[model samples]
Target: MHALIEFPSPFPEEPGVVRLLEPPGSDIEALRARLRDGSYGRPFVLENGGLRALHFSLGYVQSVMKISDPCALQLGYAQRMTAFLLFNPRPRQMVMIGLGGGSLANFCHRHLPGTRLAIVEIDADVIALREQFCVPPDDERLQVIHGDGADFVRDHPGRIDVLMIDAFGPDGVAEELASFEFYERARGRLSASGVLVMNVAGNKETYARHVERLLTAFDDAVIAMSVREDGNYILFAFRDASFAPRWKFMRAIAIELQKRLRLDFPGFAQQLERGQALRLAQRLSA
Candidate 1:
């Protein structure tokens, strides 16, 4: 671990100065060369008191983890991803697109022991930092693949119970990962009752475009919850149109999951319901 250095934030309104710590001899020139070659951007660690965060660039915080409890999820969207359990409480197999700091992967590996996890991350540098993020090693139940998420989904159809799309580059979500055809391929990879969850980070236009693509792919069997903290949207699209939203039953499941996983699952479910209602009203008015 590198010594923590007090790093000033470019944003004046930001709460506190970040403390960055980078590994020694991590060649900046080499990373730049890789970036030029269309490889992943360099990743660094930031700390603010006890809170530790991972970033590929100063513009975005990829993942956050509590240094004391590395396994615990510290981001709102990450906890919201657990809402996937509401759709399939006990999924046989889960496929994750991105492995940024392995927040979702680590939590699911620890909490959902019975479920098998396969994470697809394009960046090898990000994967190399798995130890720093406390990512679990691959076993029979957990496997991390260094590859393109879109290609993985295209090759494996109808094999995933829960498919999560969180792949992103420094600028935003990867272009290929966010396209309409990619979503269609993702939909084709879902089982009969599978659920696809995606974490989208961008402006209103970008969010709308991604949601529209999901709606088109799933035939409007999609709902979304917004993370007020970072303006990130968590989208859920179901393979089965019959999987209706029953707030009462979902609330019950949320309560149960909260007790088991120690997360605000009920709160997340409520947010999803609220977002769904707001979107429905917008559609009706339009």
Candidate 2:
């Protein structure tokens, strides 16, 4: 839907927290009329035609869930984020920084049963919408922690299998989540073969900056998958593990995953190959 609502600024500074506590499907103007005190970011749900979506602002959709199929990923960026599976189809543990609408959280919990998933969310009020979004109840294999994502990684122990960072607010990626220091800490938190997947959207300059940070942090082992219409970019960065995908092998795996997930994974394989070629061309030109 990035930021175009009659809504107020979402990422509020201290002593000026904003809160909206109307039921889903409530009109934005009505919610605006009833603003109160609460968290740093406020999220409202939109229900339309058997689909429900979460948003920090009116225009930019944060997460979407099908009412008929709650575990379904309704956003292309979310689907592309799962391309990390091409590298590690079976991960031991998966962690997500943002819990907006719980699209990734719900998908991994339902599809990847053996993988334990931990989701870190900075907004407590947003966490309160777990039931609304069908985020599975915290169990042995799932935990939704209400905390800052940046700090969570900073103190997290090593050997994480898959780390997904989708945390965003009305303005876009939070500084703490995009800083070089944060990228370094993220790399430090991964296992030898762990893959870090980040979903980010920004202008060309901003996009290039994020890529630069990731390349520097992961020692140039990174792949950028850009969604067509939106400015969204899904980045996959490898840990110390060696990774040079053979297209033949990747396409085979993509075909299998496409049959299972019903997503455009074969297309993802091609996208990865093309992204690699473009990077190679840039390097050679340099």
TM-score for each of the candidates: 0.85, 0.86
Candidate 1 on 43-88: residue-level lDDT in tens? 7665566776777765567898887888798888888888988878
User: lDDT score, residue 80, model 1?
Assistant: 88
Indicate which candidate wins on TM-score: 2
After superposition on all CA atoms, what RMSD does each candidate show versus the true structure?
Answer: 4.7, 6.7
**Model 2 C-alpha RMSD to native:** 6.7
Q: For residues 1-286, could you state the per-residue lDDT of candidate 2 as single tens digits?
A: 1222333433333122223454455576545543333221468666666777776655567887898998888888998998988888899988899999988888899889899898999888788877888888899999999999989899887578999999878777888998899999888889888899988786777667877988988888887788986668888898873578778988889999999888999998889888878877886898
Candidate 2, superposed: residue stretches over 4 Å from native: 1-41
Q: Candidate 1 clashing pairs?
A: none
Give the worst 10-residue stretch by lDDT in candidate 1.
2-11
